[model samples]
Target: MQHRPQNWILILDFGSQYTQLIARRVRELNVYCEIHPFNKDLATFADNPPNGVILSGGPSSVNDENAPNINEDIFNWDVPVLGICYGLQILAHNEISGSVEKADRREFGRSELIVDDNTDLLKEIPEESVVWMSHGDHIKELSSNYEVIAHTDNAHVAAVRHDEKPIYGVQFHPEVVHTVYGGQILQNFVYSICHLKGSWTAKSFIESTIEEIREKVGDDRVICGLSGGVDSTVVATLVHEAIGDQLQCIFVDNGVLRKNEFQDVLDIYEDQLHLPVKGIDASDKFLERLKGVVDPEMKRITIGETFIEVFDEAIAHDDSYKYLAQGTLYPDVIESISFKGPSATIKSHHNVGGLPEEMNLDLIEPVRELFKDEVRNVGRELGIPEHFIKRHPFPGPGLAIRIISDVDRPKLDILREADDIFISELRKNDLYDEVWQALAVLLPVQSVGVMGDERTYEFTIGLRAVTSVDGMTADWAHLPHPFLAHVSNRIINEVRGINRVVYDISSKPPSTIEWE
Candidate 1:
């Protein structure tokens, strides 16, 4: 029941950090799309070409030696090609003898776009609209087939279109949220230019996923590592509906969980949803294995390996559970595997690419294709309570990542108490939904504080709250000053942690949402 797309758009990634943003925008219009490397052989997609092809912005200059390029056959595919930033430069270099010259001044932030052409791509966009620009190269000359459609004050050839072809190019990034009417521009391209219908929906996704699970997992037992998040819970719900009692849910208490989260989630799984749920108390085992480990990636690997080992050992006698169902989302997949195009590893998600090779289990990711927001939509469609579905995303390694330097019981206790207070206060103030993710990171550096009359030294906590549509891009939440003062004072007074609590004001480009 995976709703067959009326038309598909293929986005060739050119190493741009914002490549996924383009795909997200297209998907928002309910059209299907896929991302592939720019260097993929043109022959690979010759027979089955997409309705449109988008060239993503990248870090490399077109004039650089051995720059990334697509085969000349791509232009002959009879598909609309939209080039963005470095993308436009590449097309200029390949299609004509035009060279991408270094700009006198680089455009990094918001810029004014003067749209001279009311063509299909920029049909409804205002003439003097603000756009997000991040590029150092500019196309001064165009081929005979192309002409300037729009320009900024610095970028003369801000946008161009082929005379009689569907090819188009833009210097500014319309995919980012910073660009006004960005989504609407993408909608015009998909609906007006490519004629792609907005047919894909949550109902279609749910039906398709249930059908897929039923077909692929016929008569086989599935062991799912349920984290009680929206991702895993929705996956478990979908699989349970498909395989019924054949699916077994394993909830591991890895010691680094939120305050009182284990019993709360377990009760919901067992009594509420009525799934075959089992709890594993491996806190001591996990803590003992992670002793003295400090590196973030190393901690992730150790925690991931340990989880697999625990699962393998737990199900050693039971040979029926041959498949491992995970709640791996689209952001996790893109971060882990999409960076290097076809096969590359970024940061490993515990349930995704981090699993050891020796584990004899096949993965069944029911919600892997959906983003965080889409997953929440599916969960809502399945009747999950808003309170549960709206919970902020938690890492699989739990609070270990939030504990900056080392992992220990004392640090865990301090972090947990502080985190509980922070989250409880957010919920109390009705600001929980205003942020995508919020956490208290226990910094290794200790600060001096005066309690009553004596001097005390303890750990400092970094409070982080970010707002994002998808986990790909984010901006730090600007909580009220009174809220911050109250939370800081309460944490210093109630939790026996550090004296100072600082808020993270940085956004995603310069800083990640998490301190680690």
Candidate 2:
């Protein structure tokens, strides 16, 4: 079994969009936490109970016929329990069926929270402060065993606590920033009430991960695919530290990478980090399979399948390799096990999903439980260069999805040049680290434009730059107009890609970061 921190928080997710945010907040306190579906069997954690339990808010009302019910087993654990918006209502409804009902005035935004008592959960919070409220239902009456700890003008039961148990519930969302003292309230619960120390840090994680990897892959050879990205690099470094020369890493050039990215990344893998690595130039093979593939889904499948084939060929003669290590992160794991059911297919990832099944190898994902930023921390702890650690996230499919048309050599060349200019200018102007991700897309639409004094019809290049904490949601970066003009002029003037350039101004809801 993988080694995890002994003292951690178990967050039961109720299909809330903000559920992940709660986990993020907990991890921000340097306390480890994991999110599981609301209906998960508590018996699974019987051997290793969490230090505390947090019930996340959801969209469903407790009165609904099919509303998600509470797993009463949590209380049996005898651990400190805290519930937010919908969570609070569920606790009350569990006591009496009709205890929670629709409110006459729904609170959707900020409100003044009046503190009736500030002994424990509400400790350090001000008497009157702004708190965010998004629920439409409110508790009509509290159980005789529970006492009111705080209230608001619209919600008398804004906060409640059990008479004797260390259980608490709050109508307002303390996981959000809108709440004035939200962090303080959570600190109070995590530290004072649950008595958990903030000891989960980068150094501890690296030490534990190396030991676990060593135990799991003893005397067995492991093969890892390198994408030159932070996650894979960190995984490779960690595995190498555990088993040294027993880990073999392969970096494949898929023909769709950025300009000079293949050699540049390979040099770092060999020289800077000094891991056992092999650079495979299968660009011709990848490009041949990608020819005439116009649909984005097909493009991703082609790349993923091609990747598996190349990796399989590279290791076909080596029967000693028994494990395949991937750079899968926590968000991907959470989305796979979501209780909300399968969401619509926006775009398929380019990871080699079929590698293990085809290659007959056990899988190893050391950072599978860490978020993107957390992986960066692990990378830093492993002594990866700071510049490489902060590199913007690149899709596994590379420039395939960026081109909104059929893949081809000329188109790839045009995109590479345009993208190089945009990215280089961002760094030159000290704006590279400002945005989470920035890229240039080659649009299929061709428009008329004038360069010098001639009318020209050429494909337009779309420039996208976004500010985001995680790629889950993003807003278009409001770059300085003058700086954008400079990049646009350079792309149009330098790259021979006929004419026009445009900037994407849409956010993640209606439009994704990539055009495809």
The residue-by-residue lDDT of candidate 1 on 123-216, one tens digit each, is 9888899999999878767888888888999999988888898888899999998999788878877888888888777877788778888888
Quick one: best TM-score, which candidate? 2
Q: Once superposed on the true structure, which residue ranges of model 1 sit more than 4 Å away at CA?
A: 1-6, 41-49, 105-108, 337-346
Query: What ranges in model 2 sit over 4 Å off?
Result: 1-3, 335-347, 352-357, 509-511
Provide the overall lDDT of each model, using Cα atoms, as 2-decimal numbers.
Answer: 0.85, 0.87
| Clash-forming residue pairs, model 1 | none
TM-score of each candidate structure, all chains considered together: 0.93, 0.95
